[model samples]
Target: MSVYVGNLSYQATQDGLTQAFSEYGTVKRVQLPTDRETGRMRGFAFVEMGTDAEEDAAIEALDGAEWMGRDLKVNKAKPREDRGSSQGGWDNRGGSRRY
Candidate 1:
């Protein structure tokens, strides 16, 4: 399980997140996604801790806590939903069909 941390400053870094979360327990990983076009931090991150207990502790402690000039939105991360394919619009391919 992992924790979702939101409302982060654009300047926040993985090391900073690791350091902040490490106080609760061992931090396994920190993922900070970025904008594909601009290549900028997305103002959120996912932190994987050693155990659920540690994650809970960190969540309880950090949620709504002000950090980096923003209130943290910490909680368990929801499983990623499969987005299927990117070509989900009207089928314009050349195919003959009676209307």
Candidate 2:
């Protein structure tokens, strides 16, 4: 299962996540997304665990937990389209200008 972790440190690395989650179980993969332009961590990442139980353990232990002084928000990751931006809105008029 894949879990999403948020409110992460900008300096966090894939290995850092892997090691942290390894306490629960084997980590399939730990991927930290980075901005293409600045090459900086996006403050979130996806971790793939070996099994559902492991995923559950990670979520239970990591959710709302503090790491490097940041409160880690852990949960199953929603797809890109499923996650609306912080602004939270939809354009009923579509992409075109009404003018």
Residue clash pairs of candidate 2: none
Which tens-of-lDDT digit does each residue in 1-32 have in candidate 1? Answer: 89999999999999999999999999999999
lDDT of 2 at 96: 37
Score every model by TM-score: 0.85, 0.79
| Model 2 RMSD vs true structure | 4.9
CA error at residue 58 for candidate 1, angstroms = 0.2
Q: Which stretches of candidate 2 lie over 4 Å from their true place?
A: 82-99
Q: What ranges in model 1 sit over 4 Å off? A: 85-99
Candidate 1 clashes between residue pairs 3 or more apart in a chain or in different chains: none
Best by TM-score: 1
